[model samples]
Target: MVALKEALARNGGLWIGCAPEQREAPSNELVMHQRPDFDIGLFELEPPLYRDFYLGYSNSVLWPALHGRVDLIDVKPRYAKAYRDVGRRLARLVAGAVNDDDVIWVHDYQMIPLAHELKALGVKCRIGFFLHIPMPDLQTFKAIPEWQDLARCLSDYDLLGFQTRRDLSHMINIFRNTLRGELRANGTMGISGREVALGSFPISIDVAGFRELAASGADKVSPPPLPRLIGVDRLDYSKGLPQRLAGYEAFLETHPQYRSRVSLLQIAPPTRDDVDAYKAIRSELESLSGHINGRFGTVDWTPVQYIHRALPRTELAVLYRLSRVGLVTPLFDGMNLVAKEFVAAQDERDPGVLVLSQFAGAAEEMPEALIINPHDPHDIAQAIKTALDMPLSERMKRHSALYAHLESHNVTRWSTAFLKQLTSVERIGPDGVAPLPGSTPWSRTA
Candidate 1:
């Protein structure tokens, strides 16, 4: 929504399709709802279709699959029917709202099938679809009962975007091998006379906004009594929260001298509480934190401060600035924005080190980060020690490189680059499809 709002503000004449309930409410970035003469239209769908098709099937089935949790994918005949029905309904809504020249950008796996439905309805607008999560490998993808149908449905889009080259490659490989679709060298797939361009376009944070927040003295609201280590993440199974707690405990055990002087603050906002796996992971994290604090607590100080609630952006920025080290260890993430936010909030005179996970997509771009394997508690512990103990010269060099990269490629740059490429694809019709325009073939090693 943030990206769309920014894009629309720069270039108006956009009509968004959202749930009828949100029609009257204005978005935080744009006052489109308050604009009584706005062309935006909200449509209604049956409650069962919204709940079962979108929330149930799309999130429960496709979400886990894309995130590499093949075990959690549950497919029923009714769910597939519900998915198709909702897709058709959304197609009608989009068709009604769009014109031939309008560029339709669809977000995430929730509306994968909608592109095909839109094409079927003769909506000739250039459709772009961006998948926000990891695309599972072929083996895991094939495990889904309707994988072939899903792949076919996705090919209807003019351009398809993924958070990383690995994700885009995985999708291309699946279509070519599993679905037997023809793949062009440029990552375009041909399925039943339709061509879709596949590309990697990682999402980014609002660098200027965060920098302004940090510069405006909003990041130093209340200084901590002592130097602090912080970890901010959504409470999810993929975040490796238990491992992070274990690592902090290991750090405490390894460096007993710093125990009383340094403390760790973990701010995890709970999400997907309805899912059994998510609930189980949250319980395990709580148990692990309690065990560590019970064993390591002193008369006046606790080794770990765990808060399982959401903090406002300003407060989080303040916490980021106060902390001496930003610990971001996700087991698997498309792109962790919190890592970038932490870097942007730093005071250049005394910037904090970022302990990032190698598995996170952000690590591919921010190589200066102290990358570690989240599965190894010892590695994480040592990284923490190294980050805290590093000399000023070394810290400045790493921070400089990371900060420059982040500033150069802010959210505006990311959105503009993606939409520009998508628009270029639209200008050149399906017949103009070629191998990726300018870059070398994307490789995992690269």
Candidate 2:
């Protein structure tokens, strides 16, 4: 959402389509609400349509599939129809809102068929799509059975943005093998007469802003003096929260010397509470945290400080600054921004170590982090100990390298790169270059 907002702010003349419930009280509901930077309009769709179609099928099904969780995909006929209906509605809304000069930037899997719908409606704006999550390989993608249709639908967009080279490669491979599309040199593929450009533009954090927050004392909220190790994430299934607690327990058992000397401050804000999986994950995390604290906590100091709420940005920065180790071990993620935030918020004088998950997208860029396999409790335990015992020289070296990377390529840089590529693509002309045929718009299909 931040990325989309930033793009719109830069481009100007933006109409944001969201659920009606979200727009009722826009100030509190919007993520980056009070921006004076650009002319932005918010348009809300009916809640039932958004929830049943967009959130249900798009997020619950396609989101998991893209992130390599084929087991969680639920593709019902009704859900598929709902998905298509929502797309059509979105396209109609966009057609009414947009002008000739406006550039349509579609976000995430929720609106994959949106571009096609807009095209079918004869709205000739240059459209671009970005998938924030990892695009799974052919085998995982094909499990959907409706994969070809979806892929064909996506070809309606002039440019398709992915998080990494791996993601772009996956998409290209799928198009060539499954759909028999002609692959291009610059990560693009031609399918059903439409030319779609595939490219990697990694998501990032506001490094300088985070650094300022860490340095500032204005929003500091000091907790009771405790040797804190931090894990900041949304309480979601993919975050590996239960396994994180188990690893912490194992660490205490194996390295009894550091028992009361350290404590984990797990700042997990609850998300998607309406979803069964998210609710179950929250319950499991709470239970696991309770068990661990029960086993090792004393009256004076609890072994784990579990805070199930989101903190203000500055307060989180302060927490990040105070911590000695930032443990970010997600089972799977596109680009865990928390890892970057933790790195950015560290004190240069006495920098904290970041024990990151190998599977996280940030790990690929910031290899200096103490990478751990979240699936292995033993490995996580060992990584924790290693991070704690790491020498100042080594910590400084890793932190410096990671910080340099973050400073060089921040979120602003990422957004600019994607939008630049998106705008550079030429639309198919009327006479010689025809609009891609045989590609069904999402709204029509729905």
lDDT of 2 by residue, 226-325 (tens): 5679999988777888888889999999999998889999989987677667787888988888999899888887898899999888788888888889
In order, what is each prediction's RMSD in angstroms?
6.4, 3.6
Off by over 4 Å in 2: 20-35, 218-224, 426-446
- How far off is residue 412 in model 2, in Å? 1.6
Extract clashing residue pairs from model 2. 84-446, 85-446, 88-443
Candidate 1 lDDT score relative to the true structure: 0.78
Task: Mark the regions of model 1 whose C-alpha exceeds 4 Å error after superposition.
Answer: 13-40, 185-187, 426-446
- Candidate 1 C-alpha lDDT tens digits along 1-446: 56556655666655556555432333323223434333465555556666667557876788777777777877766677777776776677668767888888888887888877777777877888888778878998887677766776676678889888888888888878755678877667765455678888888878878877776765347678878999998888778788888898899889888878888899899887776777888889889888888988889888788999998887788788778899999877888888999999888888889999998888989999999999999999999999989998888889899999998988788778778888887334444333332222112112
Question: Model 1, poorest ten-residue lDDT window?
Answer: 437-446
